[model samples]
Target: MFSASRGFVPLLAAAALTGVLLGACQPQGAEAPPAATAGGPVRILSAKGLNPQAGEASPQGRLLIGRGKDYTPLNEDPKALFDKLEGSMAERRKTGWAIVEALLEPQKLTLDGKTYDVPLWHTWYEGMSANPEVDQKIKLFIAQLAACKADADCHKSRAEIAHEVMAQSGTDKNLVRSLVSANLTQVLKQSEGFDRGNPEDELGQGFTLFSPSFVEHVLAQAQGIETCSNKIPWNQAPPSAGQFSPCVEEFPRSAVMVKTNWDQIDGASPKVSAHATDAAAVTAVLKGGTWPKPTLEPVDPSGIYTVQTTDGKLFGLKSIHISTKDTREWIWITLWWSPKPDEDFGQDRPASLARFNGGVWSHYKMCVTTAFNETDPKPWGSYETAQPALAAAIKASYDGAVEQRNPAPYDKVTTWCSNPNLEHHTGNGRTNCIGCHQYSLTWNELKERPAYFSDTYAASMAAEYPQYGRARRRANFPAEFAWSFGMEFQEQIKTAREDQGFSW
Candidate 1:
């Protein structure tokens, strides 16, 4: 994941991007006659179009224009961009060393004006510490970039940055080169007189800076940091039942299998009940050692299992189940191994549980509100446009679930329950729709299971089970899901927490 694949390539690429940007900024057309004044604020004059201002202010009072165009205030000056870089470096330097300590401090990052001492910062650091050289170089580059006034200045400083980053790139010279090149390109783009060309070009370059490929490299390093940080014993006591702490346990022996039943069971009579029974059956098979290999099987073509179930009884159920009750009912199955009490489960398990529960609520809400009233302009016009409408419906449904007690929209079941057999359990009071959905096995392990339900299951399931698919496809689904579920969750969490007075 390190950006610098080759030692020299990134340096050269950085130089090239700088050149392109600088070329774009240069005055275009014939040389203009000497202006009466030295020209206010080194305005960039170009026929090809100058780079837009880097920050809030314009260069001097006048805008820089094309050689033949009228004299207007420049959107930005090279010096101003350089100053911004310097300012960012200063801020980082002032706070960078203290990042770990600040992050580890209780009640640091705030949400909705409330401080959350969640392990998010620690998790981030875990991911960051892996590639110390990359982190060091990036930090150093930030420092240098902040101080650099021109491309040449950056180039001078980059040698040191390159050396630092290169030392840590391992044997992957190509990766090192690529990273360095990209960084240089970014630095150059930040310079004055660089031309971005068309909108597509500008967008492509801008996005690249924030792209997953870039973020992944940073995150991969962060993950390494997480590993190291986790190894370093904390002085604080373990977290309590509901509060987020580093004491969370990892689940052992977890797997997901997709199951489909060709038999068309009555859609009305508790479809998921049959599926749950089937899932139990599959679990029994896997536990009984029926399958020749210890691989997970599908409860249905669409359902996923971690362990092989005998006779495929659980392997037959297809649709996921949900009851429209105010109370929550979910099955927690541990699928992975971990020695440490708190570090055994996958990272995403809690989130997955929460999402699954929330998703059920969402579907139920959709069914109740929009099921009978099909002619009411169909909330979002039609199923084709149902995505956004579904989202709105889910949010409204969550609100409904929390407010009404009697004449409940849905029946109440168990208050909250997890399989007592599991080694690490979050228990009832603290658990919510979001907490369980955050598990890694729910989405990560399940994603690997095949979809036996539809020929188009790969495509349709691609919408849900992204982890089983190609990298690019997997990358795209989260954003879509976030858009689909995120808005609803935000609204729902607020209402649920307020009504329930729940703490996380």
Candidate 2:
């Protein structure tokens, strides 16, 4: 899986997705976008669009998300990101997160009479300890395995794997401590496990052994940060040019997912949530003060707003050329949350999640990609529209002559959850999540870059999207944006280092 044989791809069998190209990007063939029944699901394309390039999976696809038959494909740069994100969210909601589970190869560890499905990090000790005594025992274990393989009637015992190690240590106590505690030592902390399959490990799964203190820090930061939320229209689209028309900041709290004493589910109340996570407390902790003690309200359930495509067609599929295997529409349900109960956002929160394509992007319709109900009537800001002035300010600030926060870097951070799973494989496509800009820690990183808040940068971003000359995403976004895993790592590292009185 590490090498490029299987496209350098890992095991992804559990998804509705057949296979990913990851070669040259999936290219869109010459064809009009497919059409959904006026009120039906959109039609999906076949998976024949794979083009294997030298070192990249160049998937060129356009998911039709607009009016029936007259689909707007999300094939271009900037707008593509938006539409793709929405598409991915929708897919996840459709599949109830089987797509997410596909990303993980959970370890089946047998310890004591009970088995624990430990995080990947704990698997490190299952191999050789690099000690001769241990290696000899490992040899014996291998021999036993071979003998059993030769005997069709024989079954391998789970404890047999642990025997060699436990025998040397005399008890399971030392082994358990070493596996959990010693593994955290600085040297081992930097092992291959830390970086391997990062995309999967960072899916907000709450599997990592996060420090108690770090979790608190997360809640604190989230509490102080203001919130910006938008509810999907129950009957119509928001008026924004991006297709999210007539959107507003506030919706009934029912629009937010309800948590139970037992678990957290991802829908408005009535239809038992398709996606459920027992880690509601953790999610609330991560959400910080915004949730306000964040307990799930009584089952006095809020209702759900189902997204039904006109003509039973998947606008996403019609707009793009992709695998017919991919599902067209999900049994989609939406929930939005924000800290501002009073419904006022005055630059207090990073709205990394919402954008209306109201800025320079507003002028281009075909290039603007978005879910029909996710955006607002006008998401653009004055700063994003100021070209010459913004461009000039950016040049001056980047050159180091001026320290300007004048435009004052401000972007909203929106979160999304979905099922069915978007075919984009960066992460488990089906799940709750923050916006991509914040997902990668890019928003935080961009703040550190020069003149990032200037209008020029916004224009540059718009240019990379469809309305402008949509170009491939610039490298800077990943190099800097830190979300999910990045956020955790940063906070954990700082906390650990400070506690050590300046140890790296």
Give the alpha carbon lDDT tens digit for every residue of 158-204 in model 2. 24433433344322111111211122111211122333243432111
Model 1 C-alpha lDDT per residue in residues 173-212, reported as the tens digit of each score? 1111122212211311111233324322211010011111
Which 10-residue window in model 2 sums to the lowest lDDT?
315-324
TM-score for each candidate, following the candidate numbering: 0.18, 0.22
**Worst 10 contiguous positions by lDDT, candidate 1:** 364-373
Candidate 2, lDDT over the whole model: 0.22
Q: Once superposed on the true structure, which residue ranges of model 2 sit more than 4 Å away at CA?
A: 1-85, 88-90, 103-106, 110-289, 296-476, 480-504
TM-score for model 1? 0.18
